[model samples]
Target: MRQMSVRRKRRDRPAEDAAGPQVPDLATKGGRLAILDDTEMARIHEVSVTLLAEFGMSDAPPIVAELVCAAGGRMTEEQRLTFPPDLVARALAGLRRDVALCGRLPEHDMALGDGAVHVGSGGAAPMILNIDSDTYRETTLGDLYDAARLVDALPHVQFFARSVVARDMDTDSLLDINTCYAALAGTTKHVFVSAAFPEHVADIAKMCHIVAGGREAFAARPFLSLNINHVAPPMRFSPDAAEVLVAAARAGLPCMVNTFGQMGASSPVTVAGCLAQSNAETLAGMIVAWLANPDVHAVYGARPMVTDLRSGGMAGGSGEQALLTAAATQLARFLGLPNSTIAGATDSKIPDAQAGYEKALSITMAAHAGANLITQTAGMQAGLMGASMEAYVIDNDMLGAIRRSLAPVEISLDTLCATMIAKTIRSDGHFLGHPQTFDRMKSDFLYPGLADRRSIADWQASGARDIRVQAKELATEILAGHFPQTLAPAVDATLRETFDIRLPVARMTKP
Candidate 1:
């Protein structure tokens, strides 16, 4: 027994499927939405516990420098490091602050900390997906198996991040165990592997031991999680990748730290020295998840992007990724953790006008700076290292206009109508649909696809082909008509013979 628990059958809500594409929760405005306070979240947990007791991590990985010298931590020089902010506030007081993501048929699962805006894609970067055709810059593996079958058939992609980087005749652990068995044989969601070490977290712990059956039945049922990457400061993290993130946080699953500090290089150039070395490399990977399991689950991730050096590349604009996404989402929701930070990435590779004014100020200050889990929403470009199907259909219209301007306002007093404005000021014409304009028009109408509210002879006889040719014909009609969420023919023949999946037989041209 003792198997279930994928955080007890994941779901915060919305998976119903009367034919997909519903997604629009953004953590309820008509309900609550608006956190981060406690004196600015205890001043972002006392500046990430004074940057891990005065500057700790860097280059670590001799089994995470032998568990930062068996937890007492102190090395400096030779894979440089240091720790003990009481072992990162005892890994933020025994972690696990909510971690959902399940749906092998529980109504198609989809939900990540409710406050909506999940969309993910791109990690490990080889990007440049067949943009403008003729294999423009060739990044293949059939473009990460058609971007993991169009991000498991996008319902605004809730999770996915082994985003695309395939070039290994085996770069140490058979390329994330054959790119996580070809992105779980083309997406059923949940992916972010990047486990580049700890023997690729034992090949993502042996593809969760051939899908939940070993290593304590895949650690009481954790499908796959290891987006690890905390090597900031000319490179940190290597005590053998913090002892394989303390062996996948003592097998409870979760190591998504991802620290990116490059304002002037190795963090702290400004933007509060790169959100204080990405909040001390995500609380020193939550102090190796409180020395590998105080109750594991430490994501507090980051992306930090920007190394422009006057156009050397990597400045997905919007005033430098909207001030590094409102100071790393106000220092990761003032250290309450679990907010990987985002805002429709755009180094502008076609969806021009600096890709719609740098993707509407980093996806509207990453939804009013109260992030939970939002990565480079849809295909990126040039500075973020290009990936445009027309910037993923103008980032699904920049995530339906920053989720309808973070919704919220629905006050009463009959919403200030004052008796329909005193009988429409004696009928001098007023409201457009009056039930308060049909209750604020679907929370402020946001209908866009290829922008440009036409006029010039109705956009030159309609179909004046722009918005990057209708986002490259909607990425060739979603890579030839979509179809996500698959894998079930006896779990696709035990994941195509535990990852051997043929396709290399091009030898007999003897015809």
Candidate 2:
């Protein structure tokens, strides 16, 4: 009777009372929340087109420059390639809008072009928040692998990118190879990884080929993609990164042209100007990718970063940052290309109230704006410089709440059920054991694993643990016991023999 009473109380509680922190969404199919009107959007587009035709982009490799020139772009004496509006329009028209990010497992595949929202983890932070010690420490290759595995188990985290840099790896080449290996071995989900050197791309591709059984098979369904920070803000290509983009394009690997524009620092302070600059630079990157291969699959990564002018530091947790990223998502839709952007990154050192509000505000804006791929949604802190295992678990719950907000409410004659309502009122005075409640429980509501839900008396009696403490305990248990064996022993042996795979195979299979 006591257990039954408790279950009845839980079922009767209102959704708002039971829900945890939610990422927000207000728009749905047939209705959109637009931040910019059609005219404003057209004005931004015109500015971007003019910027490309006038000032142009710099630091293109000789071959890339020649390709652009052949496509009717003008290479100035100063080596800046000025793209005519016609060239930009041509590239935009020929852009591959439909893109597939495949997972090693079939169920994890996601389509990007249809405005489907997918949230996941991202960043290459150098440090991690050690929950046990409550101190910061350098992130290692093992930390990166563990992050992937943890996110793999999280239902809301649909994909995993290499979230932290492996500082213990000595050489750049070794770092690049081991980063790829660690991420691939940790999860079957599609991985987004960056290479330290352009020359190492072919070798990394070969390793991926072996994992996929053969070269053609890997090309047919790539489980891994490359993130190229191909261009710096203010219309300039980072030469080495551009070379890598070229190589990845030649190999036919999917790429995300990620460019960060820090408002008031690397870009204009005004929001409109910042958006125009970012859009121009992003379009400039697409032109280069098209030049590398006309058929290359790419995503427009418009990262709207913020800086504290008073302190000269990154303010990723600010409202301005959120607005800019949401606006960037709108621009991607306007261009008819798949897009990605960063949000939910907090400057707080730990998962506290500051982290919660900052994360919720930015993440809700991005998700509500219909972003296809919302990155940096988990395991990041201190403005993308630190990551936390416990934070990942907490963020997963938050994402659940946000997703629920997006779900449309249904109302129809069958759902209304006038007869059932009348019978319940007449018979029980409350609908405790209604068949409708039991049938829709799982489908209608999201229950978080880490969120606390107890009365004051029960909580006190049960040794009241804070949500962070509970989350820490849960994260530790998962890390200790969850050793996913995605790769077979023979395949692991072959990879180790072939490349400088630094992460020990034993560590992957054992806690």
Candidate 3:
């Protein structure tokens, strides 16, 4: 009778809470949620389950499967398995909901999933710049350190992205995980990562140890974060990837399952198809993780790009780009989760006319669509390869402009008070020094060096500075004036010990 009473209370609670206003239709507001009907979502969910059960993920290693099974799952054929929800829930039962990324300023409590727009640097894989030379060389540890420093130095950089560089010892996949952790721990910034192996998950545990101080630190407040990239299309999760998802849940780490879709290839050629596919991918990963542990803290992140068949290239930023971005944002909200799409990307390699339009259009839509966190804010060129300081400068300026686009139009009496308008009513109306002029003009106006708003003669007199020129100049300013946080002596020592595999250089790296 006691056990029956407990279960009854649990069952009754969900029903009691189900009453509420229906979710606002994001699509009717020109958003993407309308693309996914309940029937289609159910169908895709079944497809993902079937794929996991029948095909299973490739090379999940018996060891990986064993840990899951030991945790009360049943594995039949290679990928055919079932997780007892009760057992999964027990593992995540102790998990927390919030993921607070620390900032250099102690007052800046950078929390994720709070519906605020938090921007950072992000990009697609496949090296564009030679990170070795810091100009044209392959990616290296020195560059990674400088990148972290640079990001830490920027006040608006809410979280530190792996930014760029391989920097891993011998290119072993396992080495990448902790290498990033060490870099993040050295700075007072939160990190974003691509954890490739499950064994490396323990390295993330070490990161949590360093940042949070141990299991208690993690349980109390987790600083460790992970990025899980779901397979593009004909979607499936790899066994190792599956293990990492479960690992994060067991360790109480927050993971963002990112979708990198290319239209007409991995998804339907239409925007609606892309939304359904993107939703399917995210829901599948979430379901797998949630079913494995309902207490897991994972967000749906979409990094989808369109494949240009004619050129055999991926379109980094363009008008069609937002179809994936805006729709994905709607999907995330539809499922009651946070969203991660992108900003600061361009399809053009050279910073030119095309790059300007593509980046501006796509980024504006991402903000208006309401992505909680957007990546690729800087250092993108040539469709996400070609990361450059010049590009980073351009992105920051561009982001400033795009954010303004999303600002709500002024319609309130506070904005259009007739009394204030009438107070300065003169025939000449030259109230330049009026009190309202000082108060209100500053709020609505943004002076721009990158955005062109000048007369023809004035423009010519100023040497007609294009965005690229401004970008280069701004990049120089950041390198010269921006200052990253100074590390604690003990933390500095640990950073050295962790990466002392090679000699350290205190200056810019050579190719």
Candidate 4:
């Protein structure tokens, strides 16, 4: 494995240092919710092991099958590759625990496997909720770039992934290249993108290389990683996706092998059964990546969702979905691997009270469950088919609240405030004017940006705007001004000259 270069940019350091009161990167230290006990975890692991040893994986591509066979897996009569228990154990134990996903700038880097919580946007939504027209429309490449810039300005949104598809792009390869370009051009934060074909991986890599100054620099500290869903439910690998996974692993880019099994459809109805199946599938993905390259930085992503049995449709925002995803996160922790999961995906078509409550419940549950990386926390609505600009801003406030909730309560003598309390009672008769209160106001509490917190009279006097209206206004303001200058003029020109850079430079700078 190539060690990621952690050299800091000289010019960017001062600005990062001066960006006062850093959002403390936190983990759930105390109230770590675990739905699965040791015994249950053991059961899930054993079941997963059994499934791998017997049921095995089907539909592996020729390269994946060869890799599996080379790694001591056996081919069954049904043409499925069966992995022994020891193989799974070895892959699990050999995984690199302290994985640092390096960013273009030092401040954007994320260290995984410490149970630290990080929230970000997620992928592949086909439709966009247009605030201007008050209707849903097909997503475009420009919309993807705008969404990335909006997320970049949000303090609570830690990383920027490709949240919506570029429906305007005609070809898959074009889609692949342009999506990668949009994400990197929109945010300097660590990026996550995908390729349609294994061949397109090199094109995306070349673009990243140009942006990072050279191939060596990009390989040394890959600013972008691939989010490849390697498998369908019940341990079925897509041949094309497998090829992409193999290519990404060999390229030294970190891969999140996300397995999203819909309950009662792709997976078993019971939570434990769904978890066990997803675990087996997740381990299968890890095994393939490990076999391709033992040092591959693989994240055990479990995104098992629920189905509204009555309609037989996805119920991503349901309470059951929250509980199931939280449990899956626990299973990932039990295996001691860096993990990611879906949270805050509302089934509502619009950003409303239902969206608020559903997003809060799921996001809070996943954060409390010790998920290292939480995706789908912004923009996603209508059970992951649609992305909303207004919802992303509102979700930022919710994410801040979640982070505050996960933060440990400092009870040291300095924070104890015994002296300050006594002094305030004795002299001022109130703590509002005290130094400690003033000092801790911004540092301790998180104020919402879009949520209404005014009296009814004040609210009515201002504009009588609701949360969605406020969020839309804020989103518009942010979109109008927040053009990230992550790419230099020379680099941008080189990329446009070298590849089919679809996004015009003028559009990126202005609107």
| Candidate 4 residue lDDT tens string, 406-478 | 8876789988888878887889688887767766664666555556666787677776778787678778877
Better of 1 and 2 by lDDT: 2
Residue pairs with clashing backbones, model 4: none
RMSD of each: 20.7, 5.1, 12.8, 5.6
Across residues 371-438, which tens digit of lDDT does each residue of candidate 3 receive?
A: 77788776667777656666655555565555555555559887676775676674446667776666
Residue 216, candidate 4: alpha-carbon lDDT: 87
lDDT of 2 by residue, 1-511 (tens): 0000001123323354333332234232211547887788889989989988888888877766787888999988887888999999999999898888898887778788656777889989999999798899999999999998888777677789889999999999988889999988888888999876689889889888889999899877888888889777778878788888878888878888889988998899988988998998888888888888888888899886888999989999999888888888888888888888898989999999899999988888887777878888988999999999999989988877776666676799869889889998899977658878765653566666567666877677767777798778768877886677778788889999999888987787754
Better of 1 and 3 by TM-score: 3
Query: In candidate 3, which residue ranges exceed 4 Å CA deviation?
Result: 1-100, 104-108, 113-115, 124-136, 173-178, 185-187, 212-215, 218-221, 230-232, 291-293, 409-411, 425-427, 449-464, 480-483, 498-505, 508-511
Top lDDT model: 4
Taking all chains together, each candidate's TM-score versus the true structure is 0.34, 0.92, 0.77, 0.93
CA lDDT for candidate 2? 0.82
Local distance difference test, candidate 1: 0.60
Which stretches of candidate 2 lie above 4 Å from their native place?
1-31, 416-433
Residue 56 miss distance in model 2 (angstroms): 0.5
Tell me how far the alpha carbon of residue 213 in candidate 4 is from the true structure, in angstroms, after superposition: 1.7
- The TM-score of candidate 1 is 0.34
Q: Say which prediction, candidate 1 or candidate 2, comes out ahead on TM-score.
A: 2
